[model samples]
Target: MNKKQKKMLIRILISAALLIGFNFLPFGGPLRFILYLIPYLVIGYDILIKAFKGIKNRQPFDESLLMAVATIGAIAIAIYSEVADHENGDYVEAIAVMLFYQIGEWFQSYAVGKSRRNISDLMDIRPDYANIEIGGKLEQIDPDEVEIGSVIIVQPGEKVPIDGIVIEGESTLNTSALTGESLPRDAQEGDEIISGCINMTGVLKIRTTKEFGESTVSKILDLVENASSRKSKSEDFITKFARVYTPAVVYSAIALAVLPPIVRMFVMGIPAEWGIWIYRALTFLVISCPCALVISIPLSFFAGIGGASNAGVLVKGSNYLETLSQTKCVVFDKTGTLTQGVFEVNEVHHNEMDRDDLLEYAALAESASSHPISKSLQRAYGKQIDRSRVTDIQEISGNGVMAKVDGIDVAAGNSKLMDRLGVKWIDCHRAGTIIHMAVDGRYAGHIVISDIEKPHAKEAIQLLKKAGVEKTVMLTGDSGKAAEHVAADLGIDEVHAELLPADKVSQVEALMKRNTGKGKLAFVGDGINDAPVLSRADIGIAMGAMGSDAAIEAADIVLMDDDPIKISKAIRISRKCLRIVYENIWFAIGIKLICLVLGAVGIANMWLAIFADVGVMIIAVLNAIRALFVKNL
Candidate 1:
């Protein structure tokens, strides 16, 4: 317990003891009243102060006001009963009400504190300082002060301070804080590492590529910290309900206290029994405090976001979490989203020249381009590219590259490039990407390059089906043949292929129109070209690791490990959180309405009122905290 909770517990204990001891004494009139007032003041002084402040500030419809008015009126009725009928005043009920309310408040405080600690522990990835070599000695400096391209030393067990590539040394990285996976990843020279990973085994030198504020750790921390600001629809409903419900119940309690008493004397020709009716009204007010629905709804969403972060999924806000739970159609970008995105030269076709010579010419002509197909050709050549051997490199946007290799013209691209060169090319009947090559204005050969599917890509689609998703679709810029081959292998329900960036956005818009009221549609992608489609969907899911920064920036949810399986896990977490939210809303409202009716008819007393108010709040809070346990979901 925190210090404030500890103090409240002490006050509750003291007040309960005083009330019990004073009850046993044979006290009768004002002496009994004065003694009971001691416990009341001890337990409820803060509540009374809050109530008074609420009235002073023109906000008198809160729970504190309800509690203050009910207990104070109960005391006044007891005093009047003693003065008029010589009956012993009963002051224990009033003090007991305040005592139980404080106990409930303490429980709520502790629960919120526990939830905050869980989220804090999961996001403990901020680096304190960076080690920079200065004057033949290493000095610790702020990460923000280090400029781009500066080499910084990282010792064993230190956090990577900025996003950069490893320039020297080898080490094992504990990425659990970032990815929620316990296994360490190996890092060597030329490997790109993001900030917030801990170096576990070796000393390394890193060249900073970004400032601290633009690093991954800073973006994640900023996202999580601001999540609560965007409230879900359910949370907004509770806020509106409480504003109207609290004042309406307070006015009804007033009518319950006054109208029936006047009618008994004037209409029914009977004694007005004002004391009994007023006591019932006090019980009514306590039962209608609205504490449970007001507090627990928001807490449920907060816990859900915390649990998602622990599973390596980052939800930007509670509003997105609500939308994600309603997803019925999932659209995916094929390249990096479902496939390995690593291209390999599968076969050489129609080669009239030596295989080695063909590959060397293809690699040299495309050496200046950093495209994946170029890289695959360079990898297949198995030799360092000498850029000096190539000259006059001209790149065609939709076709390919044209360059001079050893003073001979070499063109490597699709059939369109060969046609533009006025050379007859043979079309390969391969399902993979085919690149045709030309030498000295004649068709030489073609090569086949294919992307490997991810290990869990098929399983991820199946899981989405099992999780109640109605349809699964894949959108890609690859050829129709290549796209259909992957879609069939992965069991995707629909496929759209050979689309540009603008075409992807139009596809998503058409899909959204088809899903008018059925359910929301989510688009998942990992490339910079996917940002437009990601933002235009119902919910945008981006791959955090190896995904372009533009895609992550425009996405609503981020999967840290870039694993396809996490997509289903994220959906499950959202569904579970929303389930808890609806459960608390109905449970709290149902119990309070039932108890309010019973109190109106005089069948419920102040003890039952305590249960109606404080007991229900404690139960709702416990239920909200369950959203934090999502490992098995």
Candidate 2:
């Protein structure tokens, strides 16, 4: 418990002891009233001050004001009964109301603090400093001071301070903090290591590629810190409901006190029973406090976001989480999202020259491009590339590259590129990507590269169907044969192939129109070209690790580990959270309404009103905390 909570606890115990001990004394009249006033003031001074401040600030429509008015009115009636009828006044009910209200407030504070700590511990990936070797000695400095291309030494058990490529040494990295997976990943020379991973086994020398502010840890922290600022539709409705509900209940309570006694005295010619009506009005006011709906609704979303972060799913806001629960159509980008995106040369066909010679020519001609197909050819050649061997490289956007290798004109691309160059090329009957190659005025074979599917890709599609997703579509820039093969293997409902970046956006728009009112459509992508479509979809899910910076920037939810299975897990988490939110909403409001009607007709009393206010808040808050336990879901 915090200092404030401990002090409140002490005050509650002291006030309860006083209220109990005074009941045994033989006091009467003014002495008894004075005795009870001590405990009442002890338990309720802060509430009275808050009510006074609200009135002074011209904003007196909150729970504190309702509490202050109800309790103080009950005390006034007690004094009236003691003076006018020679009876002892009862003050226990007023003190009990304040005491129990404070207890409920304390429970709420503790629950929020616990949720914040859980989220804080899960996202505690910010590195304190970076180590740089200068003059044969290591010096630790702020991570913000590290610059691009500067070499930093990450020792065992220390965080990698910036995103960079490993230059020397080898180590096992504990990536659980970033990915929420317990498996340690291996990093060696030439491996790309992002920030916020701990070196577990050996030392590593890394050359920084990005600034500290642009690192993964900084972006994640920024996302989490700003999450609560975006409210859900349910939260917005509760805010508007509270604004109108509080004042309406205050006016109704006033009518319950004054209007009925006036009707009985003037119209029915009976004695005016003002005390009974006034007591019922106080009970009605107590029952009308909206603490449960106001506090628990936002807390549920906060807990849900925290739980998702622990599971490697980073939702940007409660609004996105809410929309994710209603997603019925899921559109996927095939290359990096559903597949491993690691291309390998599966076969070389129709070679007019030696296989290694054709591969070397193709690698040399396309060495300047960083596309996956280019990298696959370079890997196939398995030799260090010399830039001097290639000259006059020209890249065509949709075709391929034409360059001079070894003083000979070399062309390496698809069949479209060979057609553009007026060189008749033979097509391969393959389900993978085909790269056609041509030597100076001669046809020189082709290289077939294929991408492997992710281990959980098929299982992820099945889980989405189990989670009630109606349609699953795959959109890719690959050929129809390659795209359809993967789609059929993974049981995807639809496939669109040979699309550009703009075409992907148009496809998503057409799909969105097809599912106009059925449910929302989500687009998942990882490359820079997918950024436009990610922004155009109803919800954009980005692959954080190994994904382009532009795509992550445009996405709403980021899967930290770049796993397709996390998509289904994220959707399930959203549904569970929304379910809990609605449950608390209906439960709290239903109980309050039932008690309010009973209080108005004199069937309920102060104790029942206390249950309607504080008891309901405690139950709703406990229910909201259930959103944090998503591991089993």
Candidate 3:
């Protein structure tokens, strides 16, 4: 407990003891009234001061004002009855209301503390110091002070401290804090590693590639810390509702106290018992306090964001979380989003020469090119290319390569290149990129290569369907056959193939229009070219692990591990959070409405009004805390 809570607890204990002891005394008249007043002020002095401050600040329509008005009116009635009616008034109920209000307030404070601690525990990856070798010895300095390209030493069990490339040594790194993956990743020389990963075994010498401010860990920490400032539509509506609702209830309470009494005495010619009516008005005020609605609504969103962060899903704000919960259509880019984006040889069909000889010629002819297909051919050849064996090499844009390998005319390219050489090449009905090869004006066969799908790609699509996503679509720049093959394998509902970036934007817009009555559309992509389409969608989700910087910046949410399955988990978290929010809203408002009506009709008293206010608040707050447990998702 905080110091204020501790002090409030002490005051509640002392006031409760005094209220109990004074009930046994036989004192009467002003002496007993004075004795009860002491305990009343002890329990409610801070409330009175806050009420006065609110009025002085010209903003008095909050819960503090309602509580002060009700308790003070009750006290006035008790003291007046003791002096005028010659009967000792009930003062214990008034003090007990204040005591319980403080109790509810303490619980809310502790609950908020716990919610913040959950987020902080997951974000405990910021390193305190970076060990850099200034001379022959290592010196520990602040991570922010280290410059890019500086060498840093990471000992066993220490964080990587910055985003860098490993130049020496090898180790196993625990990346759970960053990726939410439980397994440790192996690191070796020439490998790139990000910050926030723990060096588990061996020492590593790293060359820093990014400044501290631009590192992955810094960006993630900044994102989580500022998430709460961006309020969702639900939170905004509650704020506006409270602003108008509080003042309206205050005026209604005043009318209940004065207007009915005046109507009874003048129009109906009946005795207006002001004390009885005033007591009922005070109960109405207590019942109408909007504490439960105001506190629980924002807390639910806060805990949801924290829980998602723990799962390696970074939601930029509550507004995005709200949008994610309503996603019925999810559009994904083919390469780097669903597929592995790495090309490899799928097969070598109908090779006239040996497979290795055909691949060696293709690899030699395409050795100078940097395209992905060329790299894939070289990787498949699995041998060093003898550059001296090739001569008169020429690359045709949009076609393929033509070269003389060991004084033999070698043509390795598409069917267009074979047609240009007057060689008839057989078409292979394979669902991949085919490289047609010709030797000395003779057709030699074709080699097929393709990008492999991710391990969880099929499972992610199925899980999304199970989680209530209605439609799944894929957009790609590959050929129609290749896209259709992948879409069929993954059970995608729709496929748009051979599309440029602008074409993708148009397709996404068309998809958005088709789903007009449904929930929002979300686009997931991982390339610089996809940034425009990502930003144009209702929600942009990026693959953070190997995604481009532009795509990450344009996206509203990022999957840290580049795992397609995290998308469904994020949606599940949002739905659970929104469900809890609506539950609290209906529960609090329904109870308050019923209690308000009863208080106005004199059916409810001050003790029941206290329960209607503080007791309901505690329950709603506990329900809001349920948004924090999403590990099973």
Candidate 4:
């Protein structure tokens, strides 16, 4: 709690002590009225001041207005009972009511502060400064001060300052900060590192290709800050309802105060007695304030969004959160999404030579190279080659690597690499391309390299259906056969293959047409081409681990982990959070309904009406706080 909350708490404690101490004493008459005033002033000071300000501003139709009317009515009752009825003070009820109402208001403020703090913590992922190279000298500068094309040195255990290319040095980066993936990714010379990733080890000197404001980290912070302003359908309705609700209730309270008194004076035999009905009318205003409903409902949404941010999932706003809860259809992109974006040597084909020999020579030739395909070959070999036994290394971009291993002119790469080496053709029809190796200028063997599917891919499909996704689809630019094979393996219901980014968008549009479309359809992707489709879908979910900025920006929801299972998990969290919000809304309304009927009939007094207002708010606020504990989701 802040200093203000702390002070309020202290005041509440003092008032409680006074109220309890006076309860046992034989304090009666004038002395008892003074006892009640202590708690009343302790709790209702700020509220009374705020009410007076509203009146001065000529906008006295808020919750404070309701509270003021209710509080004054209690004091009036105390005075009337003492004067006319020859009774002791009833101001204890008045003070206790105001005290409870203040407690509820303080709780709400703290709850809102907690929710805002949650998002603030997540926004802290962005780095504040960067080590920039100026005139060949490294200098620390504010991230905002750094411009494009500046070299930024990111050392071990430090965050990458801006999205840039690695001009020098190599390291492993733990990208959980940006992408929820726990695995550390290998970064080498020329590889691009987005801002906010921690360099686990090794010195990386990067050239800042984007300005600080335009970097990946800045955009993320900006997105989170503006998220709450955009409203979901439920939130929008609540806002609009509250606009008309306050004035309507105030008028209703007026009607209750006036209409009954007039009827008793002229239409009935009884003389007009304003005191009894006016007090009830004030109670009616207190019960009808709707503070609990207005504050807690939006607070629930805020807490839900905050909870999601803690899990590394960024839902743009309550609108996206609401859409995610209603999602029934999920579509995914193939490469770098359902499967590991990186390519690797899955199989090695050797017709004459041993498989081990074919791999050893291939690793030696490809070791010095930096391309993703080369790295896969080197990893597949799984051992270091004797550099002393190699000579005549050459690189052919878009082809393969060539070298001399133990005086034999060896070439290992794609079919392009083999054709350049003038090697013989080996007929092989397979799912992925076999990298044909040429040993001594003759056909040796082909090393088949391809993107491997994520281990949880199939399980993610089952989980999605189990978690209430009605349909699953795959849309990709890969070969039709490859797309079908992946979709079949994963048990996805629909597959659209050999599509460009634009085609993917159209396909998604067509699917949107096919479904009754009651619920939203979300597209999941992590590649540049997938960005367009990701934007077109009702809610775009991006794989943050490998996702491009285009995809992340276009996406409504971003899963920090590349795991597709997180999608279902996100949906589950949203449904649960939203359910809690609805529960608070109903709880508050139910109490108000009972209190409204009772107060109008004169059975419910000021304290009971305060319970209907302040007690309901406290309970509802407590319920909203439960959303922050949904990290177990």
Backbone clashes in model 1, listed as residue pairs: none
Tens-digit lDDT track of model 4 for 98-121: 777777887888879877886677
Score candidate 1 by lDDT.
Answer: 0.90
Q: Kindly list the per-residue Cα lDDT of model 2 for residues 464-513, writing each as its tens digit.
A: 99999999999988877889999999999999987777889999999999
Measured by TM-score, the strongest candidate is 2
**Candidate 1 local lDDT, 1-633, one digit each (tens):** 788888898999999999989989886988888889999999999999999999999999999999999999999998998899898888888988888998888888889889989998988889999999999899999999989999999999899989999999999999988787788999999999889899999998999898888888888888888999999999999999999999999999999999999999999999999999999999999999988988899999999999999888889999999999999999999887898789999998765698888899999999999878899999999999998999999998767899999999999998778888899898777897888899888888999999999999999999999999999999987777889999999999999986777888999999999999999999998846688898999999997453246755889998888689999999999999999999998898899889999999999999999999999999999999999998997
lDDT of 4: 0.80
TM-scores vs. true structure, each candidate: 0.94, 0.95, 0.89, 0.79
CA shift of 215, model 2, Å: 1.7
Clashing pairs in 2: none
- Give me candidate 3's TM-score against the actual structure: 0.89
Which sections of candidate 2 miss by over 4 Å? 132-140, 149-151, 406-409, 440-443, 544-548
Candidate 3 CA-lDDT value: 0.88
